[model samples]
Target: MPKSLHPDICDKLRFSKLYEKYAQTLSNILLYKYGDILNPSDKVQEAFIKLWENCTKVKPEAVKTYLYTTANNMMLNEVKHQNVKFKYQQIKPKDYTNESPEFVMRKKEFSNRFEQVLSKLKEEERVAFLMSKVDGKTHKEIAETLGITKKVAEHRIYAAMKYLKNNLEELNKK
Candidate 1:
């Protein structure tokens, strides 16, 4: 934890050299992993800032892992927040042949009600559920992205499904 890197570490991670060597590569990795869901450039910048703040504590050899892990965690949190906020706002009807007006209206009504129920779920449960159901992520994938155990991911999704089912049934009864 030296304020200035020791000579050996400095060779690998001099402040200026660090960005030149690693920034674009890290950004590319995050972009590939997250697609358009996150701003890779922004996440990369944030990770660099964190790296700078913890420079003394981070070993030069481990800097790449540190940067990637930080950026990935940042992107995951941003994706979860944005996914929830943007979910219902961007709904679009799929193309269908000769649908009746009543059917269309009913579909919209059901969608709106489902969105309401989803919004009422606990944040962790909602995130897990949407990641699994909407994004087509498996429990293992969701666990990795969210930095949780697979068991936790499974429980969260199950809890979310139970809530949605019970609430939707109540809505239907009404």
Candidate 2:
């Protein structure tokens, strides 16, 4: 008999069954880590989506690990975003009037350029970059969560930062 290249869960029926079997466990894991602030059910769905997207790469036995890692990463990102939003909300609207027209236009331009540069990053680089910058994770933590080598994660984050810096500076000079 030949060994299968993909996990059994890569099949639709098997994947659905796996989801049914592990969905509660995934939700509970998220709840334990974050209480209700992170939306465990929603994170569970997102983890399953990721699992399906990477179905061929995942081994059947490691499903739990994969789900747990992704769920934790997702929660961390959400927490960062929530903190930023809360801080922004606390600022008085009077701060908006302090910007000169020139500053406003430049700020808008820079934001557009930043989005474009970010969009240009490869998926791997973007993931590593956001994990490092947004979630404030170390290379080792990023690698363990992403299931990549620490060296690879470090390289990806470096490449992403280099790309963003070079592109944004060049764009601003124009």
Candidate 3:
């Protein structure tokens, strides 16, 4: 199989014609929407590749709309995510580190609490959370680096936060 035709669906694509007509339209929409942020051309090509991979699943009547929607959604999400990450990175601290006895004691206590809570997490969850928060990566980037879905990356992060919150609260009471 050339991958255009799956066992259940017919291959209705005229590859050159379809590519020529839809490619530029998709690229233009993404570029206009996400300009000066990331490369829309690459994102368009990626969306087309995804479409081609599942060509059999797409009906000829809806392929254009499907491609456009997928590309647009992807680009918009990427743009929003980039903005959030930029804002997060811009947060600066007044002091680089605390050196006083009281500050050092609090830091050690927080570290111990963090380590205790971290030990309770599943190995994969801990690694994903650390890679995302400590190392600083967006969910999509973390997903790509770990070969996992963005949803899974998000879930792991959420679980880690919940665990840390609970553990830290307990530590505070102690």
Candidate 4:
């Protein structure tokens, strides 16, 4: 037996009306069910787009279910990605524990904080600073690699360092 009372949702008029009727409600449901970790509005839009693409295939009755399932999967994929990221980033403590646990904990905290600040830097600044500090590149080398002027490269490195210094002032003092 057919699931929906209405026919297929291929007609543009029917699809538009269906979208208007259910879009906000679906967004609310996704946010409530899945939390705000991912943007529910974007997920809802994607789901609707999928339905529209497969409108000829999906019966009008199943549109709601199809949308929710697609959006839910998308949200779950993002959550899964985050979990995998944390899993790989998980710190493994040394079995010997030569350093005190307190020291290790403090080190990890500082490392995480430093990473946060570093990630917040602008792309140009971060790239210049990393090349200088991590790769031991000179300002001229950085300029050649980035195709920027030496002064611009030096300025980016300085700016990045200033930002890091300001944000990590407490750590620098200690």
Best by lDDT: 4
Whose TM-score is higher: candidate 1's or candidate 3's? Answer: 1
Residue 68 deviation, candidate 2, in Å?
A: 8.1
TM-score of 3: 0.43
Q: Write the per-residue lDDT of candidate 4 for residues 1-174, one digit (tens) a residue.
A: 655766688888988998897776567556644556678889899988899899888887677778878998988887888788888897676577688999988988988889789878987788778778866779997787556899999999999999999998665685
lDDT of each: 0.79, 0.79, 0.71, 0.80
Flag regions of model 2 displaced more than 4 Å: 1-98, 170-174
- Which of 1 and 2 is ahead in lDDT? 2
Q: How does each model score on TM-score?
A: 0.46, 0.48, 0.43, 0.46
Which portions of model 3 show Cα errors greater than 4 Å? 1-13, 90-174
Better by lDDT, candidate 4 or 1: 4
Q: Pick out the ten consecutive residues of candidate 2 with the lowest summed lDDT.
A: 25-34
Candidate number achieving the greatest TM-score relative to the actual structure: 2
Steric clash count of candidate 2: 0
Using lDDT as the yardstick, the better of models 3 and 4 is 4
Encode model 3's per-residue lDDT on 44-65: one tens digit a residue.
8877787888877876666677
Residue by residue across 1-174, what tens digits does model 2's lDDT show?
566566457889889988887776567546645557669889889999999999888888788788888987998889898898998687555446577989888888988888778878987788778767766779997787667899999999989988887887763354
lDDT of 4 at 145: 54
Sort by TM-score, top down from the best: 2, 1, 4, 3
lDDT of 1 by residue, 1-174 (tens): 545346333333477798887776567556645655579889999998888888878887777788888998999999998889897688676777588989888888888898788878887788788777766779998787666999999999999998898988744354
